[model samples]
Target: MNFDDLRTGSAVHQFPGVLLGHNVRIFHPHLVNLYGCAIGDDSRIGTFVEVQKGAVIGARCKVSSHSFICEGVHIDDEVFIGHGVMFTNDARPRATNDDGSPQSEADWKVELTRVKRRASIGSNATVVCGVTIGEGALVGAGAVVTRDVPDFSIVAGVPARVIGDTRQPVSKAELTA
Candidate 1:
């Protein structure tokens, strides 16, 4: 189904539900388990990006191919989610909830996942739930992020830490297209 038809705003647009925002662009074959989802303008959800319910992607964001933005993740503007990056919002997960029904909002402890503006998460990175990746933070490739990433910090490794400051001047290689 085309999301352009049912796009509505405010954080939680559901599956078979509305997905509204300014200039929202979703690549084809995107599998979204929709519920409570909102995306700001000029945002690109690349192929294979599954945006679960309650996932808010802000303006000018690029969610790369094969990435998973799970429920309750709030991604700010100009963020780059590299290919295969995964964001999980639930600390505890169960296959099924009580009453023998599949898990819903009530089943898991849903914590807020916020990725601030201009932060770049490298390819194949995993962002665990309830952690705030601060503005302009850089998470290296294949990193498993558990703790919070401070603003302008560069982190690499399992359970990411402050390895360096990314606020320095950009080199020619970094600056060049």
Candidate 2:
């Protein structure tokens, strides 16, 4: 392998002490800024993934390409964030304030969004602020999550209504298999 011929992107650390756990891989790191974020062990962040300030990603999580994880977002262990998934911190986003000035951080509240352990958010899903995606819940592709999802449930559509329950009664053989 020729060193000069190899193509690689830089991982720009804007903030000091950004804790990255063991065996973590960030691809095309130069395309985004990872500031004040903590990524856990065995995690993989794909190209164009922007993990903003104060965002916490747990162990063994996979955040795909072009995903925006803003502040006040907490993703638990084993979570899957698909490509193009966007998370909003402000419920009501405004460009300017009442006095015709640009809205700063103090102008609005930053709502918290939590994705519980083992939850999977599909591609192009938009997660609104102040919502908790329950454990093992699956948000379908292009779904807009607006509220708290129940545990082990499958949610889809514009408002992300519960489509089905993942917890089904199973036999001993099924569990063993």
Candidate 3:
């Protein structure tokens, strides 16, 4: 049976020759086409997700539905990207340059956004360009992240602010004390 024959609720739009690793699961294969992107092993991509050219998603990541992973985005291993998440790569966004002409590839620069290992981005979060989300950080839902987030920090709200820190793993002796 073909992909169209599968009786799923939605269809995935996977572009030909997407570099998907072993054991990857794409629910709506017809709704996403990751031609130039590279998804690592054991990753799961939900419906309506679009991973643009040159984007790299590391191993064991979960990218939820309606998320847009644009070019210049690099997500490390074990990351959790929630639903409706948006990643931007252009800081100075404009239709035209100083010459008043339409912008071309050479006229703009693509800033890199890096999500470090084990970070969790909540639903509807908008991550701006040129920011580093540190390892194990938790970004709360609906947060607009505009700066670097420290490791194990929890951030929320517009232009996201650090609200708390993630609990570090404690040994049995420390827990008893």
For model 1, how many clashes? 13
Stretches of candidate 1 exceeding 4 Å from the true structure: 1-15, 29-35, 96-105, 169-177
lDDT of 3 by residue, 1-177 (tens): 012222212222336546666677888686776757777777899988999988988889999999999999999989999999999999999999888999998877899999999999999999999999999999988999999999998888887988777775434453222
The lDDT values for all models are 0.79, 0.84, 0.84
Please estimate how well model 1 matches the true structure, expressed as its whole-model Cα lDDT: 0.79
TM-score against native, each model: 0.78, 0.85, 0.85
- Sort the predicted structures by lDDT, highest score first: 3, 2, 1
Candidate 1 C-alpha lDDT tens digits along 41-154: 777778777887778888788988888888889998899999999988778788887678898766689889999999999999999999999999999888899989999988
Cα deviation of 75 in candidate 3 (Å)?
Answer: 0.3
Question: Which candidate order results from sorting by TM-score in descending order?
Answer: 3, 2, 1
Query: Please, what are the lDDT tens digits per residue for candidate 2 over residues 81-128?
Result: 999999999988999998999998899789999999999999999999
